[model samples]
Target: MEKFKTKIAIVSSLTAVMILAGTASAYAAVPAASKGQATEISAGAKADKKTASPEEQVYNLVTKLQPGEMIAYYIPDKKINLTDRILFSGKGYVLTDYDAYTAKAAQMNAPSLEIPETYPKDYKFKSGVLYLKEPDESSELYKKLDKQLRAEAAKGGKEFYTIPVEDGTGEASGAALTFVKGSVEISLYASHVKPPKPMEGTPVPFSNPDEKTETMVIGGIKCTYTTAPKLKSRLSWTDTSGSVNYSIFADNAKADVLRFAKAIIEPEAK
Candidate 1:
């Protein structure tokens, strides 16, 4: 009888231990599930924050123009006096603001301006300027500005050249200009005076942060110009207090740069 009672007691103790172990496992599973759910929630929130709508992106990029700022278009009519306000031209098919000089040249009764056969394939006419594929010593404008460029290069200043064009009468006519740095030709343009004030912000005008980035097209060519971080408040007044960023996509980049410079220095159009 005593032996049987002891065996029964041992069996009961083992059963109790097994029940306690099972209870502990069930309790642990609850916390594990809860933690997994919390992790999933956090991951979902992060995903929501990262995804931006297209409208939001557009709003981030586009902004209202400051006073005296206007969008200029390239006009081919030689009679049109290109001053600080207007810039760029178009292919015969497209009315664009980018290729003001080239389009104008093409429109003139003047003999077809043949780009040197040696010119790179990427170079194209925009706003009467001949854009080179690679801006280097090989460019025609660079050769003209080489001496002044070398002097500026030594001092780390941007080199610029202004070539005054003369009519048969030898009067002060439109100009062809170029900007060069060492072996590289940066930009080129031809204009009566200079370019107008540039719009502020990145070249890809976006008002929304989530909007897709789009390139500005002039003629059939893509504009390579970029604006500075800050733009001039007035197209007519120079911003001596602030630094201005300007990009020239014209063939004679310097001419386009001059246009903007002149716009700042000259009086505003009424």
Candidate 2:
């Protein structure tokens, strides 16, 4: 109930954080990457990236959004004509029921973040990203949660992020940006706060695989990280104890993880 206090995430999650890495990349995943060659993939279709595959293009558009912007994004996989805009209540830029499409999905005309394709799902580009899962602004619990998260992000010293999807809430203890050989994952809170549960997908419970955990100091906190010898994907560095002000979740090789950990300490402290 309390751990969800973190307001934001670092812009480094690969399949996740990479979306937040750049504003243009996150919101306009398609043409945002190519810049100039934004010819419609089909007649009257949303823009596509000239340099990337369709999936990479979609991923870029959905992930490039900022913390305050809101839109329901979907691929034109099923229907050719798609809705691209909506009407908002103005408070928190919340989306209302109206959307703009033959589907009648009239959004508030706040610059929409929609993409389309011809028979998109008729082929391999079968997935879409939805943005309709925000916590109700009218709900009392959500209001309290929002207040708590905003306050916690303020503690990071440097400008940090807030939850993009509605799930976790708690005061952010601290934040970290970790890297593996081919991937990088960044966290905004140090403590063992189960992040907000996504509207979709089953939430995986977190646990330290090590019987004896180790600590690497970062972001002004002594973070506890460990590895699951059997589950290579389980390699992680995080702080479950609420003792330190903050820390990082480093899932990298031990040597590099520790080295980077030491380097980030003083700057995060400031």
TM-scores for the candidates: 0.16, 0.29
Best by lDDT: 2
Whole-model Cα lDDT per candidate? 0.26, 0.31
Q: Candidate 1, residues 1-270: lDDT per residue as tens digits?
A: 244223322222211121121122132211122210111111111255763322222111111111111111212222332231222111111112335534544444222222323333333432222211111334453343344323433454221111111111111112122333344343322223224345444455437343332344332323333333232111111123222222333222434334444332333211
Clashes of each: 44, 36
Off by over 4 Å in 2: 1-15, 22-26, 29-67, 70-212, 215-222, 229-252, 263-270
When summed lDDT is taken over every stretch of 10 residues in candidate 2, the lowest stretch is 84-93
